[model samples]
Target chain A: MERLLAVRCPGLIEEDESGGVLRAFDRVVAAVEASCPWVTVVRTGICTLPIRGPARYFGGEHAVVDLVTAAAVEAVEAAAEAVEGGSSVEAVEVGIAEGTFAAVLAARTGTIVEPGGTTAFLAPFPLAVLGERDLADVLARLGITTLGAFAALPERHVLGRFGATGVACHAVATGRSGNLPGLADPGAGRRLHALRHPPPPPDRQPGFWGGASEADARAAQVLTRVQGLLGPDGVLTARLQGGRSPAERARDVPWSARSRAGRSGGTGSQPPWPGAIPPPAPLLVHRDRPAAELVGLDGTAVAVSGRGVLSGEPARLSVAGGPWERIAAWAGPWPTEERWWTRGHRRTARLQVVTAGTARLLVVERGSWQVEATYG
Target chain B: MFDSVAPGRVPGRVPGRTAAPASTTPGGRRDPSALAALDDLARRIRPTAASGTRLLPVHPALAPLLPEPGLRRGSAITVTAAPGLEGTLAVAMALVATASTGGSWCAVVGIADLGAVAVDGIGVDLERLAIVPRPGPHWAEAVAELVDGVDVVVVHPPFAPRPAAARRLVARARERQSVLVIVPGRAGWPEPPDVRLTVESSHWEGIERGAGHLRRRRLLVTGGGRRAAGRMRRCELWLPGEDAGPGVAGVAGVAGVAGVAGVAGVAGTSGASEPA
Candidate 1:
């Protein structure tokens, strides 16, 4: 009679720094929502959803999990699309059991609990997670560590000391509270009617316009107003993105395909990403197609010697044809030897130098000196 | 066609942005204001972005080395060294580190010599990594599985695969929105890749012939192919570079998309010192 599915992400929510990534949590919500209507999300990325209805619809528990997994993948993909290069959801553990708590712990282990295995599955959990930290400490002091041990304690004694909270804990600890939380999706039963259908033209408000040209003028006026509300620069125009190779990476999704995907509400059915973190990269990665030559104080190239030794101390380099500045501080002459045993072998070195102007540059030396990179 | 050198040869690959009165170069590095505006656009979309990124985060050093911005999903690039490995794996790991640390899964499909310990030491979370050491005859199929399940798949084909099979794998990668990194080996790929990156050479600093230990390395990465075409981007970046040790691996990289005839090692930020 109990079919609760618990999905848990170990440190997801608690690890959020600015709470911006919290929006990504919707990836999980939308994923499960695809399979069932009754979902209750708890803190710590733990979600409990009743699967009885979905199981019936999908034919069995295995089939339901498969469908849920697929939906979860789609949700993750959507999150990736939204943030582009963000910290995305790549994996999740789902647990199915008779009740919420059991399913939660089961999810922690990343395995499924059979229909009748709830008791055996839960008996191994440490009493520390049994709720009521103070009581759990007391129980621990009394030599009870595992739920199996605490479950052996007399019910009357537990009731006498712990009272209502104790009884509830005992019920969960003994796997008797599997049916505690109510099972109904509050949002599932209520259908959203807005995007479902557009309002008919007959229901449109009539304007006091004289002719078609006047209506067109009014529409232009309205567009200006909307632009004002949304801001002149807020509307993002599609542009080609760049990368090292794929020409596609530089192109936007064709407008027609994008419209078709949007019309399908491919995203409408999904929820937003919550607490989803984006990847941490720098402001810009400048290329090395153009470089400056760094020379030592002696007016000679700051070269890595044939013996992989520096010819002299680094002194200066012209910046993009700008004036040459003195090197303030420097480090390196790291030698690199690749394919040494073959014909294409190369032996070279590099150095990190800070200029008197306080600019940083990575200089490379093969037969000549070149500024490899600058520190922002 | 997938050569990471001489990208200008490819057809249908146009300049990144239209030429403005000031946009002389394809990437327009000469236009400082344009670069500043691009940074502003990044801030507009995600203001508090870790590094003001409009694209995915790559090592600060390797950013400008990319053809456009940073790496994107659904893009496949081949990483090769003229005749050796030379920082190829190190750079690949750095790129993947951006996504992997953020909870995404990464899989290494065909490289058998790789061990989980060394990879874990390079900052890849072993828990999220799937290793397929020996795919044998089903190398392509194995990569397909990883592409389906993980976000980044680093594959070095054990043997030459048919062009049709390679194309199918590439299509799968696009459909699934996963990144496929093809590292060239003895057998080589039957067809060209969308993007090709080659480590033309590497310069190691902090070592004296055979005495001192190498503290850092500068990898000369050349990127070209259909996407880059005539506007090939070249850079000298670090790969775990000696000083990058495990702790600094995520923060390591230096991309100087240098041009030919002293025009190499262009402008940019230091990567080895910052996290992407």
Candidate 2:
């Protein structure tokens, strides 16, 4: 069976209609992209990705799930802490099952249907879940409220009488999409597009909330005065509780106590950031700059050129005609080749070099060489 | 600038025609109980910052130049130096080392030339450190984002500070309960820092010639701000003081606040004289 994972950010519906919330969500999306690629965004609050390959690569199904969930939470927490009222938006739900619809519903309903059990799991849900008002009303009149009871109807009559949407609802009610073959090939970029017209601007989405509520504004006031009485360092902090959804994980305690809180409760992950945390994370990292081209002592471009060869002994490098520097020591010509199986493949070789006056540089040679970071 | 402004005064407004405080309405009659209740509510609302923060560690040898030996959370502090990059940075790094080791996150912003080797030499935990070399025009917003997540935010704010941005960032820091350590940049903070320390004189002595590298620094650090109008104190010391058996709490009598100020050496130093 095809393996699918659903990710949900609950409580996304309720927060101020503000851009900060969307930016925070964007970080969560970036975090997801860091771990898995085959993702189809369900909506602002939900998304799904094919996880069979990653599950096998990273130990097992449970391990990859845990890794992705922890990473998503950490990123979401960091991004949320950047905005007002964003402190409590951290619980993220993950549900795994057979198809997109069932997996998302499982995430929303907080269910983790076991493998191959999609039928039995989705069978007992209420008819309102179908979200088809007219069809649901017709089914209700026929005394069919439970999905299992509705799915038991004759398929031909349901198709003949109620039409295609009714048949689709029946397919969803019974938890089966007959058209899609259970290919199980994760590398198959079959349905989900790599990118689509950018998601409607976060505010343009339905149910946008912007201004702060009276309660939040009131909380800010209470927090200020209590700190005055107790001293700025005397604030209280909330503990992380295991929640069904991401936002709910940051337990919503009363504001009086929360008012005395410290800078978010620290991302609070045991291992903190894992594989993705760049080594050392240089305390003096410069912002992304235009790629600096590296040239050899002979003055030719120092890269794995068109003929696929390291141009020459690496020596001089310059940033957009700014200045040139000498390379003192070096290592690595590690190659990264990806998606060769698909039409748009990518390949690049990276070099780690130390400059003469003591500066570490990570240079990637992709048709041309560009400096990525400095270490010394 | 914000601290000196009157409570109800809005910028550019005529003094006599200022807006009324939250407790008053158009009728113009002041309600005593309402005013008293407002005060109580105001008192109830001040949020506590870094409730769990303990005293950030300093070298045991230099502890007398501060009004409070312990760094307080939700406070803005300023440190000024006399030009040399290493000397000024040494003082800043020494102060950050203690807080970072204590498990708090610290970030340094806008001082683009800072190097990793220098920070490492000062003994700060690089794991807990974050650096933003160029914040561009949205410098205030960048620092505010970091303020919400980290315990200590050290910034040499970009460009001349504006009152509006300054007030907003300061308020954000207060809400998050984090400390904002402003290293006065090309343009200083729009608002005055709560605690300010200036390096009076910094002398590097260990490097004799081209043969040796810098090892010991004799620093004269003086501190004075809102906390000290008359009691401004000075300290002299080796910035990365030796990690010895115990830090001195000192016998207080000379400056009463000998145990409080942050200039480091009031107990005694090898070269320079210090303030009590």
Candidate 3:
């Protein structure tokens, strides 16, 4: 099961028509994202982030929990002050466990379940914790009120009675899968995306009369026409941001009337990252990562060590199983130890490899190499 | 006639715009540098109204490779490379970088994965650049529409554009007075362009087995086409010079530096000559 740490904002759990709760939740998520990247939003107030990477970075899971709990408290307090005009702040709850389902339950009671102990930790909880009111009522009527009792039922017998949802819940109860199909709000991501990239502000007006120059007005008209032919997301304007790789440093946002202002701003305030690839960024950053293979002089596969050293001196390379070409010259193994906890963690490092005619950025994750970008 | 209206304006606004007090003296004492300075002054002092029909500025290093002083408006320039050659896209980006920075709105079509940072590093203004990554089958229509308003439209057609469609698009660019740059990578262009620039080969320097990073690339660019651009021209260039901007290999001084450490790359030799 995927180990996850979940944050449950009890005050913001229920949807509010005013959108104040979601806004507050956004602050909490942002606060958490500052210390950790890739904070996944499971719902409006509830969120989960993978623990392996951060756990290792912050020393251990206990340290990460302490850090996140403090950050969430401060963010929630500030948000509550803004939303409710200085009402008493509610206590934010956080927990860590193997699966998101168990982790969220653990968050409600503010406890951390030890690894390999999720099923034991969840045994005493009532069926109501599953959030299935119908199943809880039926199970209560049958005198099987606790999760332990329901989990004790035969898998086939429960499926015969309760159908697919029952089978999924049973799997969660047995601690087999971290996923529950309907547990996460599918619309949360879209709603957050809308919040992050709102429509162009009214001040940045387009066309000839008021602010924009004549050329901008003409370009806006034709770009809008192209948008009509190819949807709104078709035409995009590029913006530079701070990141470790070429793809991360730059992003293409859909072109709009506001883009005519052409403010290609940089992340001036971003903290410097140590392992970022040196300048002269690649000409192309592949959208679909292509598989690659790097072999040493004797034809053995090359890899990166735990200490960021190359396992072999690469001499030949092939991409997507193509014919091998000699590695004429190469640069450093710019190692990025993002997540190196266990076997499946994304412990990857990048290298700039030049063949007879081309230069490419190759990343090796899980002992397999992939072409990340090309200096075309 | 309007040259004196902004007599000081031209030199003040443009860097490297020398007053050329020595050239003010008459008596057929003109030199090549003086004539080049006069030509530059003429271009800078030209009224904005005439800019609609005038050539768009290109990086000075690439000026010799083109038939005109700069990229001519209302024309098509196709960039191509041999099957396995690299740097075609880099050359195309370098071609439009100057005009884009000079306030020309440019659009890219059907070329996803364009490294905008590198484009910016090559001196292209990202703000004036719009990219239509995947126009699907409507790429021709998208390019046609963009060509109407955009000053330069760079398109890499996902498939071979029909000759008639390509001709019509070329004609549209001519009518609209927009420069069209085609990078027909794999999906070849059927219609003949006004000027076709091909990258014969590309070589990278500043990196050897496990040492320095990739610092620069040298490209061999050849230009040829019909009509005024009939004569073939070739130029050696660093598409990404030492500082990551394009520069003429011959004049950049760093050109003499061989691909070796210590001996070829002595301190202050190359850096002192590069343009600030």
Candidate number with greatest lDDT: 3
Candidate 3 chain A has its poorest 10 consecutive residues by lDDT at A261-270
Q: Identify the runs in model 1 with alpha carbons over 4 angstroms from their true place.
A: A1-376, B1-55, B115-118, B228-230, B245-276
Per-residue error (Å), model 3, residue B38: 34
Looking at candidate 1, what is the lDDT of residue A372? 40
Q: In model 3, what lDDT does residue A349 have? A: 87
Question: Model 3, B189-225: lDDT tens per residue?
Answer: 9889999998887888778999898887777788889
Please give, for residues B76-126, the per-residue lDDT of candidate 2 as tens digits: 777777553324445565566666655566767666644443354344544
Per-candidate RMSD vs. true structure?
27.7, 26.2, 27.6
Total backbone clashes of candidate 3, pairs 3 or more residues apart or in separate chains: 0
TM-score for each predicted model, relative to the true structure: 0.33, 0.36, 0.56
User: After aligning candidate 1 to the native by TM-score, how far in Å is the CA of A208 from where it should be?
Assistant: 54
Q: lDDT of each model, Cα atoms only?
A: 0.50, 0.51, 0.73
Cα lDDT for residue A87, candidate 2: 39
Q: In terms of DockQ, which candidate is strongest?
A: 3
Q: What is the number of backbone collisions in each predicted candidate, taken in the order shown?
A: 61, 35, 0
Cα DockQ of the candidate 3 complex: 0.18
Which tens-of-lDDT digit does each residue in B146-262 have in candidate 1? 564466888878888766568658765654456888876777776677677777766544434223433444566677877464357676654433323122211113244332112
